[model samples]
Target: MTKTGTRNRINAGAWLISPPAFFAVALLAVPLAAVVLISFWTQTGIRDFDTALTTANYREALSDPLYLQLMMRSVWVSAAVTLVTVVLAFPIAYYVSFHVSPRRKPLWIFLITIPFWTSYLIRVFLWKVILGYSGVLNTGLQWLGIIDDPLTVILYNVNAVVITLAHAYAPFAILPIFVALEKIDRPLLEAARDLGEGVVQTFRRVTLPLAMPGVIAASLIVFIPTVGDYITPRLVGGPGGLMIANMIQTQFLRLNNAPMGAALAVQAMGIVAVLALVFVLVLRKLTRRLAQ
Candidate 1:
């Protein structure tokens, strides 16, 4: 094509995307910028903020013992949730991709998404009920004569938080892995088999490598949001299960310190960003090694 034609095509493509691009900038970038900007400000009084730039909020957010503990706890819980969700999701996704009939694949996917039919709060609340002292699990265990007392250990704790978040994010992890698995060439498995590789070896060498992209995507999707999750931890987490997001919420609402909250939020985001980048890089390197 001529240079003018190429330019026109580029201009047309730009025009087509301009509206959504502007929308993204307005809704996403603008709010993010505002948060980062507010993180540097100081709170002077109740419902009062000083526009002067300072790092006191960041300093306290990073240095304070409580905040540091909360940050560490959030990371730990998020990691556990990511690990559980992906491990559980992969088998389901793999089964659907490799075992289920193509015609029934859509139905399986639909079933996987059935959790989305309910409100997220409702789901968390339901888990709270199931894990409660006298809840379904304890009652069932008691009826079966397995336990004498309703277990108090499962509800309103870090274990409860991990369980709830893992279940909540399971579908997010499944679909990406399903898509990635679907894209794998069946002949590669056959070729591996023909080359004297066992089923497990074929999978370890061929299937998992190609599916790493989706696994990586699912991990990030689950990890990023779970790290910042407030509702699940608030409803089911109790005191011990509360995460950095809970602290941030307290700063913003209960303590009336938006600047501190914003600083904490920024730091949480930075930690998640670093972890995600490292995860992707490490996974990619491992994937390459597995492929070879």
Candidate 2:
């Protein structure tokens, strides 16, 4: 094609993308930029703010040990949720992709996503009831002669958060992994077997390596949102389950410290970006080493 024709094509492509790009910038970029600016401002009292630019909010948010602790807790809770979801999801994805009949694969995938049909708030509340003292689990266990008494420790804890988050995010984990597993070349498995490799060896050498991209994708999808989640932590997490998001919520909603809250949010975003980068880099290194 002539340079003029090529230039027109490029312009046409840019024109096609401009609408959504502008829309995204107007909605997303504007709000994020506002938050970044607010994080630098100073708050005098409840719902009162000064236009004076200062780093007081960031300074306090960083130096204050309480917010730091909450941020760390958020990281750990998100990590645990990601780990559990991916681990539990892998088996179901593997089964559906490799064992279930191709004709029925869609049915199984639909079944896995049934939980998403309900409201997320409803899911958290359902877990609250199920795990509450004298809840279904304890009552059923007691009826079955499994335990002597109702376990008070069943709800309002980190374990409960992990279980609920894992369940809520399971479908996200499963879909990516199932897609990856589906794309694996069957002949590779046959080749490994022909070389006399054991089941575990074949998986380690071929299956897992090939499926890792999906696993990493699933982890990032689950982990990033899970870290900023305030609802699950609030409903089922109780005081002990409060994450950085909860603290951020408190600063803005309860304490009327929007600047501080914005600072916390900014810090959380930075931490998430750094953590995601690290995960991708480490995964890439490990996969490279495995290939060697």
For all candidates in order, the CA lDDT equals 0.95, 0.92
Number of the top candidate by lDDT? 1
lDDT of 2 by residue, 1-292 (tens): 9999999999999999999999999999999999999998878877678979999888888899988888888999999999999999999999999999999998998899899899999999999999988799998999999998888675888888989999999999999999999999999999999999899988887888899999999999999999999999899888888899998888888888898899999999999999999998998787766655
| Model 1: per-residue Cα lDDT over 201-243, one tens digit each | 9999999999999999999999999999999999998999999
Error of 2 at 112 (Å): 1.5
TM-score of each: 0.98, 0.97
Give candidate 1's total backbone clashes.
0
RMSD of 2: 1.3
Relative to the true structure, candidate 1 reaches a TM of 0.98
